[model samples]
Target chain A: MPAVAFTVVIALLANADIAFGQPPGGRPRPNLPPIPPKGDTTHTLTRDFVPASNTKSETAPHDNGFIQRWLALEPIRKEIQRNNILTETYIRTAFAENNFSTDFNVVPKNGRKVKVGDQRLQWHALDSKTFIFNLYNFTYAINKPPYGNIFWLVTVINCPEEIPNVRMAAGVNSGGMFWLNGEEALVLSGDRDMVVDNVVSQPLTLKKGKNIVRAAIINGPGMCTFAVRFLDENGSPVKNFTISYE
Target chain B: MKPTILTSLSILVMLATQTSAQIGQPFIHDPSTIVECDGKYYTFGTGGGGLISEDGWKWHGGAVRPGGGAAPDAMKIGDRYLVAYGATGGSSNHKGAIFTMWNKTLDPNSPDFKYSEPILVATSDGYEECDAIDPGLMLDPTTGKLWMSYGTYFGYSRMVELDPKTGGLAPGAEPVDVAIACEATAPAYHDGWYYLFATHGSCCDGPNSTYNIVVGRSKNVTGPFIDNVGRSMLEGGGKLVAATEGRLIGPGHFGRIIVEPGIEKMSLHYEADLDQGGRSVLAIRPLLWKNGWPVAGENIKAGTYVIQSERRGYALELAVDMVRMPVARWFNRSTDEPIKPVDTQKLEDVIGDWPSGNIDARIGDYMSRPHQKWNITPAPDSSGYLGAPYYKIVIEGTNRALAATADGKVITVPEFTGAPEQLWMIDQLTDGTYRIMPKQVPNSNEKLALISFGDSTPALGKFDVNSDNSKWSFRAP
Candidate 1:
């Protein structure tokens, strides 16, 4: 039995799964180890929204337990495909009359907020989870003509993942530009007549997760209207995504 | 033909001291007149007033005409001369005429200036905001017929016909619809095509002026003209010619045609700011024909015009001048369709019958002179009873087509199709008189022929075809 066990151990080591201890399930499985932490901070939490310092030890600002929970949602944001379709969301808070600035600090999931200054942030999922935060836009208005004649405003939105092997078109009059992730996507410009159709743009990359997108548009001479739609690998619209401008 | 220097100077004095002297008159843009008899050239343009030169070059400014029709565009038909002007009749209260003046000779030195009579061609039909003016004349070389294209009120171009001998409207022919312009002017012809060159967009809008010249061409003298890019002028379509280039301002009211050179070359005269760039001055340059169309001179020889001129013959600048008679008012049908003369009134019966009643045995044999190829021949007897004056012409170096006209005077045929109306039949009277008649003209037995001043061949006495005792080589308009 000792010889047989030694041979099994040797085989297991060679296969890169050999371990001496049993897993938490108490089954004789391969070595079970903890996933490396992505972010720096870690913390322990109980029920409710109480600060961690009020209940647990505040000895170190970094808590390994909090890091694991925060990183649990991080892998969900990874895209399956390469750089085809890109998706992103921008959140801007409304300003008061005097106009003040806003700052942001990273907050891990299930971790207590550390009050460093005037900034207020809470840990939440950034992807398809219910814990994701929403974005809003502020300070938008129209400008009159002569000086404002032939004006342009461009916007680009990113996708959660990359899409592939697809042709895309965007039509606008006034004009608009699109960008995917950090690379250039497409530019649609000029005086659009009654028959405005078939504007060619870059193909989209659709991954399993989040992608970055942006657009810029301009109004000229007369009224300005701009809208963009994407096509998939088979030149079909991707479903189940909502566009929110706040 | 003595050089009366004193009379010439007096005419100059009369020109300089004319009414409004130089102010508030309708500004004539590009004044150019072509008269055959006296071989003289006259110009009346903006600020330049009226000028005449025995030769085309050395010019002396003449007086501004009374009531003001600025730039004088003139053409001569037979013994009669006519001038068309703009700014002369563009007013709401003014039912002003086209400011037409007829002269017997183009000679500035001739004392027979009594033939210079001023008459309005026709007032606008009370339809538009502009009047009938800025006339361009083209004579169908093949048929000695006159055509006059002009501009009118309501932001459109208009046209009318004049009798070559009487200086009146042709019988049954009235003012017809041409093209339009935003702020249009200037109409000219080149090759066998009548080029309607006009200005589009805003003209006097200062630095923001959108003034530019656009052009269209048609095979018909009265056009369903198409531009270089295949847009019809009658459809308010044109391709840009001389637009506002760098430092050029208010470039409008242009005159363009192939210049008189030993070699084939085109030239355009336009008004624009010179280097001083104030007001405007007349400027000209050679134009190039590309892809079977014309582009400005600047575009060619600057590595453009991969194509070259392939047409022969000094494409003469001639206008057919038909004498306007009271009978011509009802000639043209209002529709765009070509109005055919009565079929029973074929060219043979309408014109004087040939002695042998055979066109091939008489005119065809005589017209078969050197370099004068006939495009028409007699059909075989089996084809049907041969008509008296029906002859099928096959001109040398051209497409095979039959020529049919009433009296070799006026032939009204559908432009694309070679209908019976395309036939020509000249009637000869016993008294050495001839009347060129269309196939089916309504009532008139004698119609005048519009002739051009050019040499068809040295053997042919004169380029004018309508006159008796001549066998000039004539081409289709």
Candidate 2:
């Protein structure tokens, strides 16, 4: 029994050594950079990245709700979804938690209606200027995976106005994505060989003090998993703020 | 009869020797005249006037003239020693001119030890009665130049250059405002660091006078110096140093360091009177240099004490209360689950002592044990508290106003009030528990005892005795 246990211990150590020696398998392995020294700010310095053209996923699912319906039915919808699937969740959660109906007119420019499920989620031409909405979630979760009981989400914030400098941090099992005002500000994806910073977003400089901020979160499915929080540069939650779906 | 006379003369000689040795050794009144010449020591301040110390500990009293100045700031240049005396002033231009006097030698036996007339270096130019109160001298090693600093108003201070030989201001040299306080007073210097030490808020008035010490530094002798946050000295920017924790009142008018070489100890002399109305007694405290700044003796015990004359080493201890979140409760998502507050006052293993005791101890004399253990741990959940570490211990020094520091931090109680003295010499009982007692007490009949931690959750095991020195122990309150 002692010899068997010793053999098992050796095997576990050998496995751990091999895992530590190489990067994880998945997407093409990019050039792995060295970790920065403690307190050194040079490595992994933050910057913004954005692309103009829409890049569609080669193998996207066909039954992914209204976004899927729009992609299958409308040529313009296909172009939009092909470009960014991250934005759908933001619009969906904003309407669902705010008790917004999908029956409202969405295209104020053309008087067109965009329907979600049986209701139209849109802004009317007459009420576009005064239209407002709110969102609240009873369940929130962001956690690491394998044994992850929560969700890992990726998001993008689209705003007409410039954002102010804010402290932004997110914790999750794998990683997430982010875009600010049409610009890709952060991309934290997949597991790496070593432990990494759970917070992957940088403190973004926004306009003076107040501005619009939108985040599109994509959470990996799991047991009892789902959550996203908006925080300021001081790592404080931006609470009681309003959100609009249209 | 002649034989009897001879015997009497013999006895007189021995008595004179003993008296000379013991004169300036005891605490003297203000109007101090002090000189550190060669190796001998001579000092006079407030009322007890002239006193001399050879070894810098034992003092023998000297003469106090009818009137001269409050107290003299002394320095030696080449062959002569110059002492700056505080006078009301001369012409209206410089009303606070602290007059300077020349003395060939500080030795009483020297024939050339004659005092000279005053040399007016500073005078008042304002109606607020700018008085040249506390004066400090510093020398620039790069150019071998001399500089002088003086206080004005309640919190304003300025500095200028004096000719090394003449002991007078350099021609065309103007006194620059080194720093200002909402209530700043005394200033001093060590190494190349010009320490603009001052007190803020109300002072001197009993019980009501809030006083505390704040300090800033500058690289240039004529400073546009800055504080920890880079705020300018002239702009009233400074970090706090010494302040009255509890009974310790108005600790200002700091004297130069009485450094005893070969003994890693530096003693800073200052003045403190009970409620500002009592007589000003010379207070001495052992000094610590942290990152090139002077921190007065730490772990001060609270209570009444006669400050020791010799230099003593004080351990450096800093406590910052941080908010801690429990792992189990942090992830608990039930909104209705009442948020529980953390118990911050559990001091069991932490052990450190603060210098405490009467006016003597607070003033840098003999250190005591009570003020040493006067710990202030965190007390959270107060809507009234905000910023950095929310809780704090407020203080008032001799000539400065009242101020406070972060929570869970201990302060040196600056006065000798007969309150519940927190100074103690803690001893571990046989059962592994500890009890504290005062370092020294005048009344032998007065039995000393340790106060309980109150109904607040028991936190006695948070502090432990550091292995290096038993004189100081880490304590949590």
Candidate 3:
């Protein structure tokens, strides 16, 4: 009976590895361009992001209603058009074909690997100290050019009770698309600069338990950053919820 | 004998160290005129940064300016902010260039924050008569034209016309020499006169800097500014506008802030603040007008005073029953009788008849009564307004505080609770009289000042500067 139980556990572990599209023992190296040297002292990068550790508890949104925690994937190289030509139709057509798996229901764990075309990318859980997450500094820290890249981010919000008439308010540099609970919530597509409350989603409900939020941001040839939070029906910040990476 | 001398010396030193400058980290040199933006106040300084204040009282440094320069001035033109600065000469060399730029917002965190490229408005060669620095901007309210005044002590202060739309030198404009022997010059418009306020004497000497602000006025925008004594500023003559006061010394770089119709304030930097380790610090004082000329007013010192209403020459007092003194029969009082001093009405004598609860306030004839004397002191743990700290006005030797009610009535609560309604903002108006306003009225946000409704009635109402009802005076009891 013990031998049978051990076999069942091994089978479950192997199934999980296969589901994440990762090898059992090690991650595969993808063919990519060479990284540039680090920036000079004039480009002082803010130390706002830190690796999400298990010992830390859940985080709360900022007083001004800004979310600052997410599980972000490394940049994926994409040959996108210039900012002026990036219209809603063009972005929708470019994003119609899936670059990776669309099964966002499963929360990606930290250090978990996934395959996008021939490239192997890993998820990084980070807690941002600032309201606006600086994607330029994040890419530059890893010796990669911060322009003309795409990034995916996800977060879990736990509500005490069912909340209705809540909207997602976001500001993004370049363009972005957001999804809540596996449903399309907001799409901000333009060659636009970051402005507070630039785009707000339609009113939606948050279930009593956990709700997942996923987003994809595309940038081209400029400083890349984004900020997001939830607002109530009366346009006030909805801060009575905890955020975590599930 | 030695101990007494030491004690006297310590008290003198302590008195010399007491200052009434703007609170918080208000350290800045050559500050521009304060401008209000998006519910906050900003003032840029000489270097490449400035200060921001949420309440106009406690200031800290967070303001952002791009170009590295000396003596920058900021103004809000329409929906955009225009900043002018001198890029080079503040030292031995006289060659410098003055540039101007525009920004949608002063807040660095805003997405609309981006400064337009600097436009060179004016310049000076090394041998020119004027060193192009310390630029001050004024958008003419009469003709709708923009003008800039820039120069230094190297030669003559000059004025030039600028295209308000582009923030550049106006077409076919030339520099016109306005004044001599003055730097950090700014232009102001009040009534029908155009005033040229400038700084004179030596600066940067800290404790020994002889810097003082002087002014001259003219009917036109350019040339022939005259002082009060019929002396032209071109001949090195200027009427003294502001000088050293209390622990603050060497006032320079005059800037004006019109808070309302009658309340005005002047902003400048003291070359040395003895209480602040001789650092250059920003100072804001009440701007009073005497005989149609600008003069710096005094900040009220904490003391006991008889609150007199300018409307009817009556004093603000508790509405309790009047207590009389012992009467002396006057039938036989005559001729060669030795004079004896009759004591004034004391608080102890009146306490027995007064009620120990909330009492209404009234304006009555002044007789130096105990209830008419108010002990005005700075409220502890209270944030201030623009110029000075909020004060708590209580009856002398009692905790009965002067407060405002929800129904626009003035009253005195038995004990001072340090509530918002109990704090008062006593501002010395431009006419040398004062306007007493409560920090907040109960159940309302409308700022109401203490007014003389009638001869014997004290109420809170909208302050009208022209009416005598809104004016008050404080006299030593």
Residues B129-235 of candidate 1: C-alpha lDDT, one tens digit per residue: 23454555555565667666666323346666666655557788776666643334444555677666665533222333345667777776667777764645543
In order, the Cα lDDT scores of the candidates are: 0.35, 0.36, 0.75
Instruction: Assess every candidate by TM-score.
Output: 0.37, 0.38, 0.62
lDDT measured at residue B115 in model 3 versus the true structure, 0 to 100: 96
Question: DockQ numbers for every candidate?
Answer: 0.01, 0.00, 0.00
Model 3 has a clash total of: 0
TM-score (C-alpha, index-matched) for candidate 3: 0.62
lDDT of 3 by residue, B1-477 (tens): 001122222322322233333365377667888888888888887545677777777876667775645668889899999999876525333566788999999887789989998888877654444667889888888987888998865446898999999999999998888976567889888898988988875455455555788889999888678988665666455889898887888898888888998889998888778887776778888999999899998767889999999998999999988888898875678768877888999999998788888999999988888989999998786478786788999999999999999999999999999999999999999998999999999999998999999778989999999998999999998
Q: Give the CAPRI rating of model 2.
A: incorrect
Output the worst ten-in-a-row residue range by lDDT, candidate 3 chain B: B1-10
Q: Write the per-residue lDDT of candidate 2 for residues B1-477, one digit (tens) a residue.
A: 000122222322222222222321133322232456657766654211355555454555553221233335666777887777554311112234466678888775677767776566765432222335456665565677887777632224678788887888988888777765322233455566766665443332323333445677877777776777665655445666666644455454445453332112222222234432232233444445567665655333332222221113332212222223234646748998888876532223121232232121121211222222233222122111000111122121121101111222222344423222222333332122223333222333343322212211111122323211112232332
Q: What is the DockQ of candidate 3?
A: 0.00
Q: Assess candidate 3 and give its lDDT.
A: 0.75
Q: Report the candidate with higher TM-score, 2 versus 3.
A: 3
